[model samples]
Target: MTGSSVLSVLCIYVVLTFGSFITVIKSLETQTQSHEHYSYDRVINLPGQPLTPSVSQFSGYITVNKDHGRALFYWFFEAQSHPSKKPLLLWLNGGPGCSSIGYGAAVELGPLKVNKNGGLNFNPHSWNKEANLLFVESPVGVGFSYTNTSSDLDILDDQFVAEDTYNFLVNWLQRYSQWSSHDFYISGESYAGHYVPQLAELIHNRNKDISENPFINLKGFIVGNPETDDSYDYRGILEYAWSHSVIPDEVYDTAKNVCNFENNNWSKECNAAMEIVFDKYKEIDIYNIYAPICLINTTSSVVGSDSHVSSFKRPIRIPAGYDPCYTPYVQEYFNRTDVKKAFHANTSIDYKVCSDHVFNLYNYTISSILPIYTELIKSGLKIWIYSGDADGRVPVIGSRYCIEALGLPLKSPWRSWFHNQQVGGRIVEYEGLTMVTVRGAGHLVPLNKPSEALSLIHSFLSGQPLPKDR
Candidate 1:
């Protein structure tokens, strides 16, 4: 009744506790397997429209079905000349609804720029110079990216963009089987801060399914002047304007005192504060070497002669004859027999240059994907975020706020990385992640300072420390 009874009771309690724990563990494993097996019913891939003049060059396009309807994406792929080994870089341009083709082709990675005759000019700094670059006109109506059916902006959220992009990649690799062995990386700017991470998460999730999917080897990601967080991004804009003396001190103080950065909703106070700042800084030219008025009339013609143009100090435009540097020109380009033959979009009716106008009409907010950063780190993918110091839109301070939110442990002291004996940027290494700031660049890092951006990207891809040429 004493020692034996007490020992029997203790043993029974231990058995019950262990059984409960095992049941809970088994339940969790079953749920995990269920989620793994859950098939996404909406993913549908269309035919691959490959571009030519092959010669191990950059070119391709693929049709895909989005929530709105059938859409087209013009892609540019750069193949390694040596033929054996090369990485694939998927580049996206951000506007919540902008064209990657406009940004990638006219501005950043692609070799061609829109000439004054509404033609293509070859660019030497194209990302194709290093890795195979792929650009997509994403979120439907951004550029050459368009939907067949007329609807109210069907695919506007982050999830839809990620899913559609993943499906497109799978079908694309199927068409170009050679890309199956290539390593992959996702790079972009502006809203691409959101696009890149979402796509990266999708790739990581899909990799768990197919054993040989080439998209699985997604090595890393690079974002320039990324819009990661809205609260800090807007606040940072004011801080940047104030610091650069773009806004009066009084206006900056009024903004700080009246506006609530946390509530992104438009307020009279916020508007008034912004108005005051804009009124003061309206005449200050921050982007170019010229006066502020020049920045406003971004599309104005160059005043000097062709010889002077050679040494012109004006802000870069998308050449002449084409639309504004940032405007969509897919419809304009594809409508031409030459561009149609180049892209193989001949059969399509009335090509739409701007797809987002038709596909992403509703306002879509992207705020929760920040948690995906953890998923990327857990999967051993390197992530790098950089900001061009002079860009007021998505300033360096915004990046600092985003990095702080990551809660990463610093691995090295922050220092400048250089190129050609100049301070190109500063680097911060933390827990295998890298965040840097380009010294004299703007919203478009590659366009404003291609060499510096390329060097940073090359270093990240190779898993090397940022270059120090000081």
Candidate 2:
């Protein structure tokens, strides 16, 4: 029993410990594989994507209603920094039938922006810098999301959209289980104002019903230039157009007098006046009146049809600051055989920036989400409604008027928020709600003012007041 015997015993113990450690590691790996299978989604690597730091990206469909063959397509980007420690953000783009993946993820807020050359460029101010981002094409007929029951597309309504979105979240969380416990937020722009609040209401109510094993840790939502109320929104638009000098005094006055914005019923005279107003701004981009249009044709055509009146009817020239033509680049990139294969996208359907069929057949039920907002505030969830001051579509004036209607006790008076020593916009806080305005930004705040938009979202997620002084 000398030193040799003790050495032999130590060697045996070390071998046993090392073997057990290897066994444990394998067990964990097996568990992770099983979990991924249950999620039924796949992570993909794109062909032309620039080299990025170690960050995981996933794209695929989550079957919300298997019986109806309803599936929602999603592109998820993990946080650029500490993903596990960051909150999860679900971003939607309103068209009611628009592709969030096309606009929100590709052009506006995701980690990559499509270049004119059909390649990807890293977005320095991507929202994923602050939180994990998930952009979805919702409502079963938008983007890559589809339903087997073709009639299901015809019956699309706000209630159904909200319910399907809720179901998508529930199942999506199951697939990405690690995210189920993280603080969750819903965000979008344009028509998403309707989608975001209504979806939040559903999640809030559903949480109460399933309090025992709540899947969604939904903490709040942020909507940019959302279509909130038809009456107030139209009223604000008219006022904004007049104030911004987009319309002449005579046209404004005549329309203001004849238009019944409250009832949403336009008389013959009012319609005529509106036509004049539209004609006045026909040369300019309605969403961002100040921004240059991307003109593809020489002759002026109607910017949008009656059914899709929000879009520009004519092709205008792309501006220098941001390319309005970016949509076509994204559409082309997504339609590539390799890109679709990499993203696990459905190759059968053609990729479009906006779906006309979904837009035309969509049965819009609610004109305002203020009623839902009232309940959301009572639940003490963080609510933020932001607008791009330059956006003619959903002007800050309308957002301001809508928030003021909430009658929440103001926690902070209106004050300027700064980014990089420059004034970005103004922010005001209430008991449970906040409203922000991005100066010189258009309908898509992040696209026009990326840094300011980044600052805005960082402040929202951190629950800190916007920086008052540069």
Candidate 3:
């Protein structure tokens, strides 16, 4: 070998040796911090709830901004088995203001369900059985996440949410470094379509920029009933409604003529035509047209009142096992002084299923997140979009349109996917994307069809197609 080549080889060896030393030191420091956090955030008891069906869960705040007292709340559950070897999956629920805690954790995929008596029950079908799960109420204005800077609430947008969420993940990883090298996936439903992809793109781009150890090994992302392309979302909403007879044909016809959904602009005629849809939805729960609206009286501030709990009445659909009146119970449970104290949540802050302030002022800056999806897909990120076909709010129709707009080649034709000896749903795979539909499910697929949702998650994480056989 030449003298110069020999010298370069020696330099690389020295750098590698030194890098290993630094990583060891870093690992020790991160582990110490993680241990400290474990003690602080470990959930001792959920009021009136039984022991978790599995390992353990923790909930608390991770300060994203100390200067502004801006902290995001998180509920973390370890995998049921082999947590150290399992992937770390972050779950987000989108209302632009929804609580991942109230919705995703408590009602949807969480192992804990708040009961009618303001108690908690163990959910057997939680996603944690497959992967370590984490849920965050993001952007510092929703759920237990809060900020002292009131002005921060006013400027909430997609970029703001993504940046804050990213900050939380980085800090959180350092505090739980054992999972730093594990595969990580972000999944959510509803408005999270925007939140999920936007955050994944940010992380993917940031990972490319990062040359050091603080990298999040983001494997893929999945979103259900997501609000993707605004144009497509609107079109899908109208089409799904009309096809399902939620609105009259004449009204749908008028809307098509007057509304420029492609650009999200509407005329006076368009507004009037669309009102028919809003009016019709009032007669039904728009999220799940077939699901009954919550008839229980939650109007009174009487917290935990059993007065509204009526005699046993079977739910319209038994498969989902979600109550229309459930959110109120969640509200009652989380808002309790004892529960907040146990959760390490701020007693002063009022918990909400969705923050109207954040929702109203949430500056939705993007017209379409399809561009972000295309970029991530090309970057080789596994992308999947699952839709609860019955969700009128963000139906499968919009998701299909959004996927088609990407112009990816079909990898597989649509086929039935089974769960519990029945056809659970359908899946259509693309070159780098997969579209899934949960039959008879609404906005929250996991809540409506837990078994099917669990089955879908299993397939996605394993990088396998949904089971074709029994």
Q: Which of candidates 1 and 2 is the stronger one according to TM-score?
A: 2
Q: Model 1, 47-119: lDDT tens per residue? A: 1222332323333445577554655465554553543466888888765655676566665656665554565
Quality of model 3 by C-alpha lDDT: 0.82
Off by over 4 Å in 1: 1-61, 66-69, 211-215, 275-335, 346-360
Worst 10 residues of 3 by lDDT: 311-320
By descending TM-score, how would the candidates be arranged? 3, 2, 1
Best by lDDT: 3
lDDT-superior candidate, 1 or 3: 3
TM agreement with the true structure for every prediction = 0.75, 0.88, 0.89
TM-score leader: 3
TM-score quality measure for candidate 3: 0.89
Error of 3 at 332 (Å): 0.5
For residues 1-470, write the lDDT of model 3, one tens digit per residue.
99999999999999999999999998888777789898888987777878545448888888888888899999999998999989999999887677888888989898887788889888889999889999999868899999999999888888999999999999888777778899999999777888899999888878876776368899899999888887888788889999999998888898888877775555667666666766676576777878877666652211211211221010011112246778778888999999999999999988888676776677767879999988899989888999888887778898899999999999999998888888888889999999989999988888889989998999899877788967
Off by over 4 Å in 2: 1-34, 38-40, 211-213, 297-321
Evaluate all candidate structures by whole-model CA lDDT and list the values in order: 0.63, 0.81, 0.82
Q: CA shift at 202, candidate 1, in angstroms?
A: 1.5
Supply candidate 1's per-residue lDDT for 363. 46
Question: What is the C-alpha lDDT profile of model 2 across 306-417, one tens digit per residue?
Answer: 3223422111211222565666677789999888888888998898777767877777677778998988999989899998888776788888888888788989888998
